[model samples]
Each structure stands twice: as structure tokens, then as C-alpha cells.
Target: MDDVSWKTAVESRLDFLQRENLDLKAALKNILRENENIRSEFEAMKNILRKHVQDTDEKCNRNMKKSANKEIHTSVEDEFGIDPERDGQRVARIVPPSTSTISSIAFYSYLSKNSGPITAHHTLVYDVSHINRGNGYNKNDGIFIAPVSGVYVFHFSVCIGGSAYASFEILVNGEVIGAVNEESHTGMGYREGSNLVVTFANSGDHVFIRTQRSTIGYVFSNDMCKTSFSGWFLTN
Candidate 1:
């Protein structure tokens, strides 16, 4: 071979190799750019997911706190009989019966004024002539609200005067528990009627005497103090 031809062939081979190397370098640069873009996108997505999780946790915590506060407020109200809306200081309380033979009582001696047509299953108001041991009785509305769950004995007595008619019912809440009816037909002497009830009651239950029937009647407590209502806790 001639020297000039050999030199031309070697220079051509060198040019081809150099072009291939440049091409590889350009491809590597493009791959590196693509990797950088992917890293930026991955970081953004991770931040978004982390923010979502944080927000969800915070919302759940707030809801749980609200439920706990509401439960605590309700418990306080039930235990103390505290109506937050009312203005006056709470003087009245529900005294739980003690563990004893005669632990609780709701006995009132007599009514000074004759109060009736105490009809239609109405709660009676009585004068606080006497109360023994403990008091859960409201003299304003003659209802005994129980402070503890127990069995109790309740009694009511009345002497219907002349020209008078009377009937009594012992009630635990709205249910009729006991009854007694008497009428003075002669309009001359007093007629006596009484009702006794042994009942089971839960805390916050109401027990009271109501007049089912009354006609031109007077429940007298004058000299003998015949009209009376009494209750005592029998079992815990």
C-alpha cells in the first residue's frame, strides 16, 4: 500500500471514534438531567403526603378532646344537680341514704292550710312539721326524690271532714303505687283513709302522694294532726 493512502485511512478511523465518544457524553448529560427532575418530583410528593398525615392527626385529636370535655361536663351535672343556666346558688342537695336500719326519712307532720281540689294525680305540698334523720323531701312540691337505689316504705293518712270526700294515691313517678278512698256521707263526723306502699326506687326517682279524687274536702291537721305523709328507706 502507498503511504498517503494508509495515513488517510487511519485519520478517518480516528474521526469516527471521536464522534462516538461525543455522542455518549451527550446521552449521559441527558440522563443526569432526568434523574435530577425525578428527585425533585419525589421530594414534592413526600412533602404532600406528610402534610396530609399531620393534618388528619390534628383533626382527630381535636375531636377526641371535644368528646372528653362533654362527657366530663355531663358527669358533673348529674352528680351535683348543677344547672348551669340558673342564676341562684345551689342550696338543695340529694343526700344519699346511709347504710343503717333507719337511714333515710321523708316525713312531714301536717298541712296548716287545707289545700284541694287536690285532684288529678297532683303532687301535694306539706308543711315541714317534722323530719327525721335525712331529708330528700321537697316541701314545695311534696315529691321525695331518691338519692340512692333502695326499697322504701311510704305512708299517707288523712281524715276527711264533714261534707267532704277524699281519695289518695301513692305514686312512684307517674305510676300508681297505692290507693285509699273515703267519703263522709253523713256530713257529721270525720272519715279516715290511708294508703301505704312499699316500693323499689332508683336514684333520681320521684315518690309522692297525689289526690285522685276530692270533692268539697278538707284534710284536717288541727288538734290531732291527723293528715300526714311519711317515707323511710328500708333496704340499700
Candidate 2:
């Protein structure tokens, strides 16, 4: 082979190698740019999540403050007596106590064990009596007898197992006032139901909870979830 021909082939190979190196560099640059974009997007999402959590915390704090400030004490003048300046005549004005006193009556009871496959018109016996201030609640019979004639507020909560449905009725002197129903259709879990009722009762009126219709599964009562009943005298 001639020297000039060999030198021309060598130059042609060097030019091809240089072009390949430039192409590899361009591809690497593109990959680095894409990585930067992905990193920025991830950071932005993290910031959004952080802001949401912070807002939720702030909202909870504000609600707690409002609850704490709901009850406050007043002076003796605010408790009784009428303002003659407003009506030009004397009228009686009496303010109730802010907290529960010795005269007030309240009771709270819960089921210590689970009740199973309750039928229609079955009574729920809350065996564990936590607070029976006036001895109005009977743990054995699941009944609350009003100790004094007044307006009363009653609350009850019931939890049922998954894949079942149950309905309960709050009774005052054998009359239904309110009802609670819980239904779970899907997987194995727990569902809860609660109801509140306000009624006027005499001193001997009876209040209780009973099953409305057929119940599919058992009621749940455990450390995590409790079936409870409570009542308090509101006003006379």
C-alpha cells in the first residue's frame, strides 16, 4: 500500500471517532436535564403535603380553644335579680349553674361484653355502670328511671360487626323517640351508630334501648369500641 493512501484512511477513522464522542456527550446532557426536572417535581409534592398537614393541625388547635372557652363563671349580680331600668317593673331572673352540682343527676353505662345475634325487641343490658349519680340507671335491666321530673338528654352508641346490619330504638315510657342503625356490607371490620334524644319525663318514667328488628351479627364491645348509654337531666 502507498503511504498517502494509509494516511488518508487513518484521518477518516479519526473523524468518525470524534463524531461518535460528541453524540454520546449530547445524550448524557439530556439525561441529566431530565433527572433535574424529576427532582424538582418531587420537592414540590413534598411541600404540598407538608402544608396540608400544617393546616389540619392549626384547625384542630382552634377548635380546642373554642371548646375550652365555652364555660365561664359570672358574678352574684348576674346570677339573680332583675334590671328595673329595662322594663320599669321587677321580674324574676335566675341563671343556672355552669357545672354539674350536687342536685344534678347523670348516669353513664357501657356493655362490658359483646351481645350476640340479638333478635327483634331484644333489650341491651349495659352491665358496666361507670357513673350513676342519682342511682337512676339499673345495670342489670338496662333501664333508666328519672329520679326527678325534668327535661332529659339521652345518648347511646352501638357498634356492630362487619357484613351485618342492626337497628335500635330509644324508648321513653314504652314509646319510641329516636333510633340508631348500623350496616356494613364489605370486608371484616366494625361499624358504629349513635343517637341523641331530648324528652320530658316524670319522676318514675322509664327509658331504655331495644332492637327495632332482626339483627344479622353480634354487637361489638371491646377496649377500642364500646357500646354505651348515658343520660343527664337538662332543666326542670
Candidate 3:
């Protein structure tokens, strides 16, 4: 071959290689652009998921806090017999013994006044008398001497105030038949507890209530809330 023919062939080959290199560069640029777009989309999705989780957590925490506070408030109301909407304290229910029978042996009495700071083993003398049909309960010594031999139902309630506690025992002839314990744990307001006793007694058996263990606060009594005791004959 001649020198001219050889140089022309070499030039043509060089041109072909340059075009291929350009094509390759274009393809690489396209691939880099696609990778950048994919990365941006991935970052956006991550941000959306993170925000959703944060919002959900916040909402759940708020709901849980609200429910917990409501439960606590309800518990306090029920325990203390407080009616928050009426803004009045609920009085304890005191149903007088049924007066159906003409010969019913029943009595009802209450403190009617605040008595307090009583020592342990002190007898609670219910100062006021509402009923003593059989003439058994003595307001002076707070003792009920049975007027007739029969089965009796006795109930007593004790109220304590001012962050203190008191324990009492309903005694029959100097024996503990039932017990009560009341405490005002919040250092304010009052707390009350009661118990009932059903037992047989002779005509002269003595029944009374007295402090036991300890007494730390004042006992409360009034028209709204009364520390009281009562007993009725159930049967012979």
C-alpha cells in the first residue's frame, strides 16, 4: 500500500474511537443523573416516615396522660364520697331501723359533735341520743346493756381527720366482735370506715365501742357527717 492510503485508514480508525469515547461519557452522565434523582426520593420518603412516627408518639402520650388523670380523679371521688359536680360532700347513708313492729328493739345514736385526740383503748362515748326504744344505750358511759335476750345487728362508723388514723373495736361484754379503722392520709379533709356485728346476747350483756391500737386525730361529727352507732334486735 502507499503512504497516503495508510494515513487515511489510521485517521478513520482514530475518528471511530473518539466517537465511542463520547458515547460512553454521555451514558455515564445519564447514569449519574438517575442516581441523584433516586437519592432525593429516598431522602424525602425517610423524612415523611420520621415525621409520622413523631406525631403518632406525641398523640399517644397525650391520650395516656389524660386517661391516667381521669382515673385518679375518679378514684379520689369515690373513696371520699365527694361529688365534684355538685360541689358538696356526700353524706353517708344512715337508714333508721324499720319501725314496722310495735315491739321492735332498736336504738340509734351519734357523736353529734367532734371528739378528738383520744388515746388508745379509750371508749367512744356517743354524746347525743336519737333513739333508745328499749332503754339500753347509755349516753353518759356509751354502753348499751341488753334489755332483752336476742340476736342483734350492730353497726358503728368512725371518722378521722387531719392526716391521722384511728382503730376501734366493737366489744360485747369486753370482747371484740367487730373492728373499724379510718385514716385521713392526705393531711386534709376526713376519712371514715365502719363495720357491722351480728351476735347473740343475754338480757344484761354490755356492748360498747372503744379505741384500739392507736388514735392519732380528731373524730368528726355533724349533721352532714356523723360518727355513729346503733343496734337492733334481729330475733330471739
Stretch of 10 with least lDDT, candidate 2: 70-79
Clashing pairs in 3: none
lDDT of 3 by residue, 1-236 (tens): 89999999999999999999999999999999999999999999999999999999999999999899788756656566555545666754343223344256788999978877888888889978899897889999999998877799999998877778888899999989899898787656778899998999998999999999667767888765889999998865
Residue-by-residue lDDT tens digits, candidate 1, 144-176: 888777788888987777777877788887888
Please identify which of the two predictions, 1 or 2, would achieve the higher TM-score against the true structure: 2
Sort all candidates by TM-score, best to worst.
2, 3, 1
- C-alpha lDDT score of every prediction, in listed order: 0.74, 0.85, 0.85
How would you order the candidates by lDDT, starting with the best? 2, 3, 1
What's the C-alpha lDDT at position 15 in model 1?
Answer: 96
Candidate 2 per-residue lDDT, tens place, 91-168, comes to 545655344462569999999988778899998899999999989999999999998887999999989877788898
Better of 1 and 3 by TM-score: 3
Residue 221, model 2, lDDT: 86
Residue runs of model 1 more than 4 Å from their true location after superposition: 1-106
Q: Which parts of model 3 are misplaced by more than 4 Å? A: 1-102
